[model samples]
Target: MKATHQPPTHAPVTTADLLRMAALYLRQHGWTQGTYYATTTPTNYPTPPACAAGAIGIACAGHTVEHFTQLDPDTLADYLATLAAFVDHLDTAYPMFLIDDDGFALDEHTSPYSWNDDPARTAEQVITALEAAADESDQLHLTGGQN
Candidate 1:
């Protein structure tokens, strides 16, 4: 008799989940904390706020780092969405220096694969991948000047 093969299972990646994952990534990279709000701007804020208020925001060491509105559909439907773009921006700006899920450091000289085709991947998976890369980056930073 032959055994049956089964595919892995993953929960749907909700907007809240994405937000939490992003916050975790930010914290891992030295961001202090994050806040979530229902409106883009707080009603009681004075003019010229230090940071633009949004549905979600994160700060690092008392400095505002990021602020953005919520994702539509409450789920990550495509890589072209704002949240994904934000992640890309963070990766580029801060150099999370992530290795691939397979434990291979992504070649800085090469382009990464477009995630548009695999929108079904869960937020947890994405965070895990990023965290692994960040860990590697931290190790490299601690051991040598390379990053």
Candidate 2:
């Protein structure tokens, strides 16, 4: 007998899920520096992979990393604005989580885009950062926030 695959139940897709998908995208497609993606479009998978922020943008595009596709501007903006995804961005409520290129919160506000493009940045570092953000989001959602 053959079995069919079932779809994921998370209909609305949370910030944590978006972050995790970004990490998965980096793991599977490799990583890039100096660009959100070599191609920078959800309609097409990036070549030579995507930067940390780029991965996040790709994640914002679809339900899954492998199937990421174009999302309307408003929808994409909504994903990018999620508190978890904002951890590394500037001037957000998460100033404490704003980190430098080294992924440390040195009281310096470095955007994820700039951090990902740093010459010294590694793919592992970027991927790990995304996963960490997801974990934090998970904890927040489980402990004190609405899903």
Best by TM-score: 2
TM-score of each: 0.27, 0.63
Clashes (candidate 2): 0
Q: Which residue pairs clash within candidate 2?
A: none
Model 2 ranges off by over 4 Å: 1-10, 39-48, 63-74, 82-108, 143-147
Model 2, 71-123: lDDT tens per residue? 56676565656533556433333233455798878655546666667677788
In the range 15-89, model 1's lDDT, one tens digit per residue, is: 334344444644343221122222345554322122111112332112232322233333224222424444444
> Which candidate number has the best lDDT?
2
| lDDT score of residue 146 within candidate 2 | 71
Question: lDDT per prediction?
Answer: 0.35, 0.66
Error of 1 at 63 (Å): 8.6
Range of the 10 consecutive residues with the lowest summed lDDT in candidate 2: 88-97
